[model samples]
Target: MLQVNNIEVIYMNIIQVLRGVSLEVGDGKIIALLGANGAGKTTTLKAISGLLKTEEGEVTDGSIVFDGKRIDRYGPVEIAATGITQVMEGRRVLGHLSVEENLMVFAHNRKDRKEVKGDIEKVFEYFPKIKTLRRQTSGYLSGGEQQMMVIGRGLMARPKLMLLDEPSLGLAPLLVQEIYEIIRRINAEQKMAILLVEQNARAALGIADYGYVMENGRVVLSGAADMLKGNEDVQEFYMGLSVAGSKKSYREFKHYRRKKKWVT
Candidate 1:
């Protein structure tokens, strides 16, 4: 379980990125955060995973609590040790290392060598394709394969909560479907809670139990995934499907007031 409560982040201690952003991820449940590029989705993830500090950003106000422990002040390594790991926007992997080596790199905090080896097998079980390419250089893998490797690498951390950022970016439709199904499976099998940051509204909402929409560093909407999917604002802006069958530009959307309100 994780809670991000009214947290604010400042980059370089000047540009404030998040303003009172709050959300929750319950045990083994998937929660989606959907918005356009500058809505602070990735920053929210970085804040929770303690990656923001790497960019000279810090949670300046409010709290990030994971299983009752305040983790806003912790570093990335400390956060990961607490069973929270993030797979960033890009499918970032060690380009020079073999797939096996890339996966092994994450097990640094893990104490048992034998258990780490067993965990690698578990990752292989989730991604059979990666098992075959274990020795192959990770950079040579295709986009879909690299995405799989990234997710597989996250699993190697044995995380209790997984922060997934734009998992379907640049992948084909079929591959997106496959990866989403795997994500659902991983949730069911590992009982790992997921906080998904995505622009793919249809795909993310399809699998998420709950959802939030952000704009300008704040949460603009929150609801059950089905409720969000059926919402006019979400349909028009995020899903690109409007009941009126017309998309509104950002300018038009700003002037157009929401008929359905959210919890502020």
Candidate 2:
């Protein structure tokens, strides 16, 4: 449903961030982009969502096409209108507004005013924990609640493609599991396409049909999720596993360098 072809992103006309990065998101499929910090996963999303322009970052080469239309030069509003919604990493919420109000904000652009209420209920169904908190001030909610609220807000837009950046960030392991399950359900039920950017390789690969590994702004590896899960390098580097299936210590893993196969 979406394609990023050899795109290069540059910030302030000088600092290049994404170099020849390319990937595809099939209709209703979960595509995971796995990488650590500064790997340019988020920047790729911004380029596709046109959020890059906000930070003086521009896609200087290649193209981003969604639903067969080129959108590399479009602005954030235009991109959002084209059925793509990016749930940014920080779990940003309207601090002063009620939870329901935050969800309502995204639906304002839709002409289906009456159905907006129904959609709010749909979001509540996905996140029942936030239902009773609808009228409460969003800023007072716990971190997990805020994360649920933000994903629910993205649902309000009724996007065909959702770019999720670090949805599991700063949450407990059980809570992360809950959210990832919800994400999987959202894809299956809504037939929505999701490009999930995550550092939690295990969780992301669990639900993803296909996955890409990024490093230093380039794709180092790409494969089916299960294949990646079984890969020795992926197991060792991302999952902290040794060849013998034992967990490696952080100190041991940190000193290891990734293979230079993609570096030519």
Cα RMSD for candidate 2?
A: 2.1
- Per-residue alpha-carbon lDDT of model 1 for 180-236, expressed as tens digits? 999999999999999999999999999999999998899999999999988888897
- Could you report the Cα RMSD, in angstroms, for every candidate shown? 3.5, 2.1
Screening candidate 2 with a backbone cut-off below 3 angstroms (N, C-alpha, C), the clashing residue pairs are: none
Candidate 1 Cα errors over 4 Å, as ranges: 244-264
TM-score of each candidate structure, all chains considered together: 0.92, 0.95
Candidate 1 is scored at a TM of 0.92
Highest-scoring model, lDDT? 2
